[model samples]
Each structure stands twice: as structure tokens, then as C-alpha cells.
Target chain A: MNTKILRVNMERLTAEFEELPDAYRSLGGRGLTSAIVAAEVPPECHPLGPRNKLVLAPGIVTGTSAPSSGRLSVGGKSPLTGGIKESNVGSRFAQTLARLGIRAIIVEGQFKEGYKLLAVGKAGAELVDASQWIGQGLYASFERLEEAFRDRVDICGAGVVAEMSARNSGLAFNDLEGRSTRYAGRGGLGAVMASRGLKFIVLDGDGAPGVEVEDKEVFDRGRRKLAEGLKAHDVTKPGGALASYGTNVLINVMNEAGGLPHRNFSSGQDPRAEEVSGERKAELIQKRGGVRPHACHPGCIIQCSEVWTREDGADPMGVLEYESVWALGPNCGIYDLDTIGELNRACNDLGLDTIETGNTLAVVMEGGLLEFGDGAGALRLLEEVRRGTPTGRLLMHGAAFAGTALGVTRVPVVKGQAMPAYDPRAVKGIGIAYATSPMGADHTAGYSIAPEILGVGGKVDPLDPDKGALLRGLQRATAFIDSAGYCLFTAFAVLDFPEALEGMVETVGGVLGTPLTVDDVDAIGKKILDAERTFNAAAGFTQTDDRLPEFMHLETLPPHGHVFDVPAEELDAVLRDG
Target chain B: MMEAPSVTVRLFARLREAAGTSEIALQAQDIRGLLDALVAKAPSVGSELLEADGQLRQAVTVMVNGRNIEFLGGLDTPLRGGDTVAVFPVVAGG
Candidate 1:
């Protein structure tokens, strides 16, 4: 099998394809990304400097009809973490890139130009002038790309917020039929892209050759069985719970379990919780003509992406899921879905991580920037990024920096990455994940919602710390799964049916022409984790770096009323191998 | 007075939805005895709640309050007066 790499130099505006090393042939997703970044990019270079390279990789299962195996990983020196950072998104990019026989794309150096976009396809690469599109929102940029490229291509673009060089900016991707629905949306990576003078990336897969697989028959059967498993499960079946309500389905359950973060991680339960819940969201979408939950990718069965609409239904905002809604909705105390939807639209247009933006806004409100639940004020704050005002620059830097500028002591971040909606104090397992994960407090790293909230894989109490070791096991398993190019939602089926593992390994072996056991799968995951840890340690990270905010230890969440009692010493046990 | 036969029944998550009540009162002496009594008394709820082992199935959490009786007490948490048992199906959301 011939593996190819595309290396683009921004300073010289040059590009080349290099042969993959024999060792990297088996690597996929995070394995490929972490390894490449650790090897090629210097650990101590300024993250936004020309020395840093952004690596985009597809998983091993990419290009196959595997269920939910379309996540693409983007790795670099995180502007947020200052450590090895890899963020993945469930977009068509990975599947498309894999089908085009592209395993990884390495973007290096910086373009001297202030604004530009890169267009890639089977034909090759081009530096497109983006002057006309400067300050364009994601939706507008997507619309323009669709108009220009037609249905022949997919586009990855950042919003005007990135052009302004805001820290919270994220790179957004066009979903199926060209909606700005998916995002490489975390850790201020968009700012890095903007700093490199990259405004957008358009991938045209038209006429591209498909991926090569050794055993098509075994691939077909294995993939089919895995698809059947997802179809059989309630959470993963088409029009399943995720499709019906997006990820906001967690609102009710998390509230009942007392893990929902309200008013900036200060409490667990919000009396206004229902106002932002999945059921309520479903009802609101129905009333507003924006209710349909569509898939982000063309072949995705679990359609958890939604096209949020204005209350008047005059214009369609980008998709808003659990993290966005919570970040813009309850985390900042805004209950009106339309208002939250507007903020979501604004962030997408400006290319910002809604979670960080929402959390940062709440922190600003806590510092008396605005009253909590000020929906209009929040809207105005986002408008600043759109306008590229001075305050807009400060607001766009995200929560950690914004908190520092505001002199606020209650910044909720780990390794500079903002916390997702789940309060760590209430959900202790995820807390351990947040504290120990090299990527910072990202639940997607080791989502404990399964055991804590969903009752999958033997229920564990959300408030208990006794299951730290078990939680770490799940996290390690999840890391492997993510790297394999399987969608994290696939865990819903796998957790219930252990046979799914055999099916996945069989499929992998068939496609790669290599016999791989489930043990190999476990080893691949460990290798990825070890590589990331090595990068972080080399970049000056240590066990002391993995810790939750001090307030979590002292403050208690109400309504069940508990604090994170897990000692730092015990929390560190997650990194120790048995 | 005639003696009454009894067995403990557990509830957990969302099983409380079907059981009408958290803990139900049974007058049977064994696992089979309690299930038969449960099916006979709350026939509308029994088939949905109990499995063939007389144990609750997937999506069902049958715990005797603080303890998952499945691990501790089984369907026999040794019932006594005022022991509020709970039954629930696995919640659909989250």
C-alpha cells in the first residue's frame, strides 16, 4: 500500500507529496497526527509561529462505509494548551480525504499575505485570494464556496472572527449540501490558521481515485454488521435520540443526575434547565421552522446536526448542538433558543468556539461586565468580534485570556482549554478526564456520561471517585476508538454489544491487508497516548499540570450538593499503568 | 391469623415509570412467587419490568434504594415494612 503525504509551505507558497515512512503505514487518526507532530514540529516553538505545523489526518476506518467513523483529527501545538493538541470533528472531510487517497495533509509555515484561502483536490493546490471574503461569516463564506465550487466540492473555512485574530475562533466546515455545520472548533486553532494567512480550504473530491483496500468482501460484511448494531441501538439508529434532539438530550438527564453546569460551573441544577432542554428544543424548533436534525455528513446515519432558525424563520443560523447551546444558553444563563441561536450564528460567522466564548462571557459577567442572563448584552459582545473592534479583539481571545484581562479569579480552564458544559465537581469521572487528559478538560476525550448519566457499561455513580481506575480504562479505550476513525457515538452500540469490537478489528484488518487483533487495537491506543504525553512532557508539562480549578475542591454544587472530593493524588492515579 | 408469604422486589433509573410506585408490595415467598404476584397484581407493568430470571432487564434499574439489589440482595432484598424500593427503565436521554 502506498501512503502519501501533502506538505504545503506557506512562506514559500510551495507544496509537495512525500512517501510515508514504513512505520507510519499502520497509523491512523490521532496515531498519525500525534506521531507526525511530535516528530516534525519542534516542541518549544511558538505555537502560532511559522515553525509549527498543522496536521490533518483521517482514521484507519475512514473511506469505508463504517458507521460513524468519519471524525477527522487536526493536531498542532495548541495555542490554548501549549502542549500536544489534537481536536477531531465529525465532518465529511475525513471520509472525503480518505476516499481521495490522502492519509494526512501537513500545512507548514506562514503566508505573508494578510488574507488568503487554500483550495485542494485531485488536481492539486492553489492559494486563492480571499480579499473579497474578508470579514465574511462562515455561513456567507460557505454560501460563496458553494456558489463558486457548486456541489463538486466541500469547503473548510474560518469566520471573520479569525481574520480579527481572536483566540476563540474555530475553523468551520461545510456539512452535507453545504451548510456551515461542522467545526475544528476548540483551543483557538482558528487563530493559528488565520495567523498563517489561511482563510479557507476547499476540498474538491471530484474525479479523485478512491482508497485501496485489500479485501473488499470481508470489509463489506464487517462494516455491515457494525452498521446493523448502530441501527439496532436506540441512541444510534437513524432518527434516534441524538437525531431527535441533537446532544441537548443530556439536559434533562444531567439535570436529574445533578451534573448539569449552570451559571458558569457554579451549580449543578438550574430551575430554568427545561427552558434549554432537548424536549423543549424539539418543541421550539417545530414552532420556528428550524426543527429538523440533519446529518453533518452525506452518509451519516446519526443525524445529530440541526439548522437553528431565527424566531421569525427569516434566516437559518448554523447548527447548534449540546455544547453550543449550553455554552450560549444556560452556562451564560440565556434561555431563549433564538437568542442562543443568534449567538451560535455569530460565533460560526466569526469562527469561534461557542463553548469558550460562552464560558468567557459568563466569566466577564461575573466580573460585572454585564448582568448574568443578559441575552442582548451577549449578542452585542459577539457583534464586537464581527466588527473587529478593540474590545472585540479582547473578547475573542477566549475565556482564559479574557479572564486575565478582566482580572477575574474564577476562570474555569485546564491547560488554557475551557471546560465543556459538564461540571467536573458533580461528574467526578469526567473530572478526572478533564484533569488528566493531555488535551485539557474536554469530555470528548473520555466522556463519563455513559456510566454516570446513560447507564451504559455498568452504571457508576457520577459523584463517586472510587471508579477513577475504571474511568481511566474507558478513556484509554476511547482514545483508541477515536484514532481508528470511528465516531465516538459508535461507543453507544459497542458498550452494549462487545461483539462490535471483533467486527471493527475484522474490518480494519481487511482494509489495511494486515491481521490485527483486538489487542492490536488496544496497543494502537496506548501508543497514541504515549506519543501525546511525550510531546507534552517535552514541552514542559508534568503531573502538576493536570489539575482542576481550586474552587472545585472547596465549593459544592447544589441540589444533591457535592464538591469534587477526589484527591489530586488519586486523580493522578489515572496516568499510572496497572 | 393466616400468615402472608413475602419477597423483596427492587427498582432502579426509569423503571419507576412503569411500576406506578417506586416499591411494590408483594405477598409471594420466592423470586418466582413475587414475579407471579407482580404480574398478577400489576399485569400492565410486569411484562415490561421483569425478565425471565425474575431480574430486571436492560434499560431497567431495579435497586432497593441505595443498593443495586442485583449485586447485593437480588430480587430478595429481604423485604420489611417501609423499605422504599425503586424500579426504573434506563433513562432515554443523556
Candidate 2:
């Protein structure tokens, strides 16, 4: 798998492809992005300044025929959290970049004037002045790009909010259908792109030299086993839970566990939450003629993405993921799916992350901007962000900043970024993930939910506080998966089937022509974590930084009536001291 | 006349579709009796919940109140009237 790094200097508007360095040979996805950012970007530089750089890389097996392996990692210093971030997304853009033999795209320097589009193709990459796309909504911007480049091209671009340098902005990637729906939506990576004066990265795959496998026989063996495991598993199998209802399936599950945050993390459960659940959403999709069991990218056997539509099936909104639903729905005391669906669409259009925007809106509600459960009111507020109102600017900076502005003390954030749907007080294990994750308040930090992973013998209590080591191992393994380019949903099958794990390890080995065994998963993942941790340390994050918000420690959540009680020492040991 | 001792058996996701109802009022004193009542109310739910070996299906997650039943003694976990038993075919997501 030979590849080169494509570096774009916005100051000069120059595009150059450099030979892939030996140090970055085995790295891909989060591993590669974090490495590039940590090595090249200054920790203290303003995230929206010239010194900050945005790096995008596909996972090691991203472009290959590996099942569900089309994930791209977009990393940079987050303006929101003042920490390193790698926001992952599933899109054809990743495969297109990987197919072009471009391992990473390092965007450097600031473009002071207007937005430009970076077009990469068989003819080699070039910069095109795209100032017209600067202020347009992403959906329209993406449509124009599709028209300009035609159907064969995939797109990655900053949204309108990102053009305004909103901290809550996320980079939108065109999904399989050319819709600007999929997002590397966690950190403020979009603003980082926008800051560099690059609005879009379009990849034309026609006549491209696709990803070459070093060992086809080994790769095929690994792919088959992984596919079989996914096909057989209950959650990932054809027409299974995820495929049937999409990711919003977790709405009811988390609510049942008393871990679902409702009304700005004030409570843990509400009967109204059922109105926005996956079960309810799937029924609505069926009645309205929308598509469930949709794949964000090709070769995704899990196919958990969906196209959410209006009552008459008119205006399709893509994939109401669990976190997005929760953050915009019950967490704001709004139970209507149509309302949440509209909010989701607005976020996609403006290039705002649904999670951060939702959390910020909740804080806005608490601050007396609007009453809770006001769906119409929430939409109007989102309009403010698009219109660049004074209030909207405050909201777009994200939850922590919004909370401070709003004077709300019940902010549910870790390291400036808002926590997702799960109330950490109820599910202590995931809370540890939120607290200790280098990316800050990320639920995806620990994807290993296996019984064996949780504990060797028994059904370990989720409320148990001694889960630091458990989370360390889980996060380590997850880092490898994120770097490998496999969808995190792949963990559902791999957790239950041993062979699936072997398949993942062997596939990477086949791609890189190096033997990586199951025993190496931890060490390899740890390497990525270590780099991120070191960068964060250099960025001035300390032991106190590795904690759930102070509000979590003081406030007891309802239903479970528990607080986040994991010891600081436990969290401290997660990195495995040198 | 007073209602018989009952626990609310709530279903979610595909489980509710199979059972034909989201909530079922079932007379029971423990998790085992609750299963019997659930089967009596919706045999489809029973088929989806248990295997031929009479063990709970691996995918099915049962919780009494908010605590997972698997951690509490599986089938033998005691239940009282007015307790809420939530069931879902466990699907992993963030």
C-alpha cells in the first residue's frame, strides 16, 4: 500500500504530494492524523490561526475491499476545547482519497482573502477559486460542487457556520448518495478548514489507481471472517437491530438503563423520550417512504445509516444517529421526531455538529433564552447561528462557552466539549470514557462493550467505579479500530466473535505487509493514545483536566440517583505510565 | 376489586414489534414468573426472548427498574408489584 502525503499551503495556494515517510508507514486514520498534527502543529497556537493545521487521513484499510472500512480521520487543534481532536466519519470521500494513493492531506497556513476548493484527480491535484461557495449552506454548496465535478467525485467541505469560524462547526462529507450528510462532526475541524481558506476537498476517482493489497489471500481470508461475523451477529446482521432502526435504537436502551440524559442532563428518564426512539423513527420512515438499513459508504455490512423524511416523505434528512437524536430531542425536553429531524437538517446545512449545537441549545434554554421542549423555538435559534446573530455567535462557540455565557451551572461537559447522550452518573464506565478521552467528552472513546472486555467472568455492574483499567483497554483497542478505517459498529460483531478480532488484525497485516497479531492490538492502539496524551500534556492539560465536569461530581442523576464517583487516581493510571 | 400483583413489562425496538405492544401488564413475583406472564401475554415475545434450551436469548437484555437483570441473578431475580421490567434486543451504539 504505497501512498504519498498531500500538503496544501493556503498562503501560497500550492498543492504538493510528498513521499510517505517511514514513520507514518503503519499509521492511518486517527493514528496518522494525530501524529501529523502533534508533530507539525503548535499546541498553543490559535486553532483558527495560521499556525494551526488541519490533517485528514483515511484508515489503513479504508480504500481496500475490507468490509465497512471507509472511515476518514480529520484532526486538528480544537478551538472549542483547546485540545487535540480527531473527528471520524464514514464517507466515500475517504475511499476516494485512499484510492488516489493520498494517505494524508495536511492543510497549512491561513488564506486571508476568500475560500478556495482543492480538487484532486487523476490529472493531479489543483486549487480552484471557490469564493462563491464561501457563505452558501453546505447542502447547496455540495450540490454546486456535484454539478461542477459531476457524479464521480466525492466532497469534503466546511459548512456556512464554519465560514463564520464557529467553534461548533464540523466538516461535512458527501455520503454514498452525494448528499452532504456524513460529518466528522465532533471537534471544530470545519472552522480549522475554513480558517485556512479552503472550503472543499473534491476527489475525482475516475482513472485513479486504487488501493493495492500486499497479500490478497490473507486479506480475503480476513474479509470473509469479518463479514461472516457481522452477518451472524444480532446487532449488525442483515435486518438486525442497527440495520432495522438505525443508530437511534439506543434511545430506548439507554433510557432503560437510566443512563439517557433528558432536559440538559438534569434527569435520566422520561416517557416522552419514546417519541424519538429508533423504534418510533423506523415506523415513521416506513409510513413516510424513507429508507432504513442505509449504508453511509459502500461495503458497510452493518448499514446502520438511514434517510429520515418528513410526514409525506418530502425532504429527506439523512441518518438521525442516537447521539444526534438524544442531544437534539429528549436532552432538550423536545420529544418530537419531526422537530428533531428538522433540527438535524439545519445542523447539516449550516455545517454545525448536532451534538455540540444541541448541548449549547440546552444551555441556552436554561439561560432563559427559550423554554424547554420548544421545537419551533430551537429552530429559530439555529437560524440565528446561520444569520450570525450576536446570540447565535455565542451558541455556535459550543456548550462550555455557551454555558459560561448563560450562567448555567449544570453544564454536562468534559474539557469544554459537551458529553453526548449517556448520563455518566448512571453508566460510570462510559463516563470514564467521556472524562478521560483525549478528544474530550467523546462516547466513542471506548467501543468495547463485551462481557469479556468489561470483566472476564461475570456481568460486571456498570455502576461499579473501578472501571479505569477496563476503559483503558477498551479505548486502546478502539484506537486501533479507528486507525484501521473499520466502522466502530464493527465492534458489535467483533466483541461477540473471536474470529472477527483476528480478521481485523490480519487484514491490517495483509495491507501493510507486516504481521500484526491480536496480542499487538493494545500496544498499537496505545501508541496512538500516547501520542495524543503527550500532545495534550504539551497543550497544558493536566491530571485535573482528566475529569468529568464539576457538576457531575455534585449533582446526582435521577432514576439511578448516582453521581460520577470514579477516583481521580483510577483515571490517572489509564495512560500506563512510562 | 383490586388489581392483581403486576409488574409493567415494557418492550423496545424489535421486541415491541414482535410482542405487538410496547407495554404489557403481567402478574408476577419474580423474573421467572414475569417471563411466564410475558409468554402468556405474547408468545412471540417469548420465542424471541428465550431459546429452546429455556435460557434467555443472548441478544435480549432484561432490566428490573434500571439494573440489568443479568447482573442481578438472571431468571431468579425477584420482582415486586409496580416494578417496571424493560426489555430490548440489545443493540450497541454510542
Candidate with best lDDT: 2
Q: Model 1 shows how many backbone clashes?
A: 19
Which predicted model would earn the best DockQ? 2
Off by over 4 Å in 2: A448-458, B1-4
State the lDDT of candidate 2 residue by residue for B1-94, as single tens digits: 5444778889887778888889988887688888888888788877778889888777677889978887887888988879999887656565
Per-residue lDDT tens digits for candidate 2, residues A1-578, read: 86799999999989999998899999999999999999999998889998999999999999998999999999999988899999999998899899998899999998888888999997789989988876788888888888988985899989989988898999999977777899999889999999999999999989889898888888888989999998988878888877888888778877877878998999998988888888888899999999987998888898998898888999887889989999999989999999999999999999999999899999889889999999999999999999999988998989899888879988888889998888878878888888889999998998423342122113567788888787898899899999999998888878778999899888998998888888999999999999998888889899898898888889888977899999988888877653
Chain B alone, candidate 1, TM-score of 0.56
Q: Show pairs that collide, candidate 2.
A: none
User: Each candidate's interface RMSD, rounded to one decimal?
Assistant: 4.7, 3.3
True contacts kept of each: 0.18, 0.64
Q: What number of clashing residue pairs does each candidate have, in the order they appear? A: 19, 0
Chain B TM-score of candidate 2 stands at: 0.87
lDDT of 1 by residue, A1-578 (tens): 43888787788777677888888998788888899999998999888888888888888888777777888888888887889888888788788888878888888889876767677788777787787887666777788787887674777776777666666777788777677768888877777777787777888888878777778777777787788877877677876667877778677556655677878787787758767777677777778887577876666777777777777776877577888888898888888777888888877777888889999898888878888899999999888778878878778888888888988877889888889988877778888888888888788888787776566666776767876677677777778887778878877777787677677777777778887776776567667787888899999998888998888888877765688888878877776674
Badly placed stretches (over 4 Å) of model 1 are A291-293, B1-55, B60-94
